[model samples]
Target: MNRSSYPYVKTPPIFRCLIKKQQQATEELTYKPRRRRRRKVNNSDFYWWGFPIGTGGYVIIRFLLTIDWDFGSFIIFMGAVAIALISGYLLIRSYYRDFKSEPPPEYIVNKEIRKKAIDAKNKIRKRYLSRPLKDKVKKLLKGKVRTLEPLTPSATVGVSEKQFLAVLQKYFGQRVNFPNGVFSIIGTTFEYTPDIVYQDSYTGLTIDIEIDEPYAGKSKEPHHCNDNDKDRNRDDFFLKRNWVVVRFAEEQVVKYPVACAYYLSKVIYQLSGIRYEVPAEKLPSIPTWDSEESTSMARLLHRETYLKEHGLWQIRIS
Candidate 1:
């Protein structure tokens, strides 16, 4: 019935930190004395340490004549005094023997032990408590939709998908397919087929190319909403199967289909380490859209306005 029992109340890091602090407190706060060398004592070293610690030679005015306490005389006298003090310090420091280090006490070790305990506790809290919220905040801030769920291969290919497919085929001839690739998570009845599947002959990298329309045509519901977890889960599913998933906006495919293909080939080369020649030499600025934003725009039929404003990749929304 005791709540303080180790199994019921214990967090290992807290217990471990307490034990570590106890160990540190009982630890001997000392050091091995520095070993002195056995070299014969140099009389010159002792002279350097002792004889030059004076400013006697800095007495600038001769006692034989009346001296003027002018600015120039005072300046010279002060300069000589500074130089003599510096020389004395350097001479003594050069040969002075000591066993003690700069901090002079081992009490700093206790401070370090306490600091380490605090840091360890902070790390434990971060691991257990703080990180999930932090991860969620980060997810919200990174508001770009990079990919979406692939279309079902059984259905007819849409006009936008066909255009993207034709361009992808120009560079990756015979390597790309339409409605040919079928994949599913194990122990599940559901099967996902990408709109176009590209298999690299050299590196065997499988690419799942998807053209995501803002909203589902029949359901009138958002298919790739930013708040929706389905597409993210879908991408994760493909990732687990070692397939690289890439999504393009329907407009991006329709407008710059050739650029879309070039971009895809470059992505393929980057992912697979094999380059394929495409007709377009310059990299096009085919900006992607947030899934939720896409869904909203599609629902309102504000595609042109959204494209005009969020046309570049710099604008982001979660």
Candidate 2:
């Protein structure tokens, strides 16, 4: 038998069934359901353009019909314009109500965003509140501690000292060196600590500012012999050391800071070779004893004696 004459083989029944099932699956996949498209709603198209144009048309028609070419016509035109504006506003409101996309549901803010908002609010609050607090701090600091009496008036030494330090920091800035207490002065390590020292950059002069309060303590010993001797010795030590001491009493500084400042400025000017004049109003008044009844009687008696010698005593006495 020739090879060409051999019978052609047919596909198996199982293979034919598999091929039919695949064709059916492909036809089912090709048949897709169409997706419904969302309608596009534009806010400006509906409200800004459409409503205004429609209302404007209505207003123009009404104006042409009612116009009389007089003052009344002008008034009527204005009225129509006003009515059109009101209608346009209502139309815009209605369009927004009917066509506006629903606002997304209210969202709980994230922790970080909420925290940032809180921080911003706190910062604003602090900015306002800090000014008054700073002013209060400045006033408190400007108050002189040395002026306070230990027992007579209520002692505000602690408060005054803190305030004084704050003022010093504010005036001089942070780089200034301040001694901790009186003990720093007496320490043995050759440490140079002045109460209030300012070195002039130009003149190379160091100013040592000292404020003295009246020591009200009563010693059992005599004044000229005991504690007074120690004080005099201290004054001598400072003087011998060539220290320029600017001493002001508690009363002088507390009652008259301007006077204190004037004196201080004068000293600085003199040392620095900078010419300055303190105002007359800023100058401290010379202290004088007020005359009491006891002193007045003594003065009268002395005056009478002088007048009698001049033979003018009787006229004055009468």
Candidate 3:
């Protein structure tokens, strides 16, 4: 009623602060940044600024310190150069925060190439060289060794295994052990034997090479189908024991025996650093087999039809 609010309720300091903050928030919500036009950054200027500070700094430091020019310096210089180049375009990125421009197409392409190269390098390293390759049981006294041994061989050996053994023996020589050579977990009755076992006696590296036939020869029942939980469990068991398991279709082993041997050699080298050279080598692309098609393979074989890479081989289920 026109009275100065009956009594002057001195605004509480917190309330006043809250009101200010709310006003600021409201203003921020409504505010739209106005685009300001500025001269585009020149290519020459950008390039000049792009020189990596780390490399430039290294040069300056070396000059000032009168560091002896030798292999060590060269190595250190290369590292500095790598750091600089990898950090940004041409310059150390952190120092030139003010510079901004759309990277040229060439620069973008080069960047993408570099990223892909790095990813490829990492993939190879992580899978084969670096990272964890396989879980090797360790001895407390000597530390980690990539082997678990005194294997319990499997109960049965398939025909395909014996056939492929001859092929592997050609390349691997005595390194290949004829199978029923599988592993059994300690304190458990579980056991599995691969078709072929390649054990590097010196390094104690073991590889399990298996041939997957779509169905059992006698039973005409589907085996090694994708949905088979037993295969996965068996694989896990061996893998945990630090074994490298390689599976091949029975057809691939029979027809492309030499190629299979060559592939095995390459895999052995990659995993255990053992190298082999095959005289007549021709690697062909083999299609991956899956469970659904394997089921079909089983049905076909039951009808007295040979599977022959039937997981959609050179022909579909007609």
lDDT of each: 0.55, 0.41, 0.56
lDDT of 2 at 189: 32
Distance (Å) between predicted and true CA of 9, model 2?
Answer: 99
Off-target runs (Cα >4 Å) in candidate 1 are 1-156, 281-295, 302-318
lDDT of 2 by residue, 1-318 (tens): 111211111222322343353334333222222333334557755665566567767767877886467887778667767767776677567555633554333312344455676567556655644443223323332422211112222222311123333444444443223433331234553333334544433333334454433321122112111223543344344444433445554334444545555566565453333434544345444221123422443444533443355444344221
| Candidate 2 segments whose C-alpha is farther than 4 A from its true place | 1-193, 216-227, 275-280, 285-318
Task: Give lDDT tens digits, candidate 3, residues 70-96.
Answer: 787777777766665665564344344
Error of 3 at 73 (Å): 70
Q: What digit string (tens of lDDT, one per residue) describes model 1 on residues 96-154? A: 43424344355557657767776676566455443332233233223222232454545
> How close is every model to the real structure, measured as TM-score?
0.50, 0.29, 0.48
Better of 1 and 2 by TM-score: 1
Predicted structure 3: lDDT? 0.56
Candidate 1 vs candidate 3, TM-score winner = 1
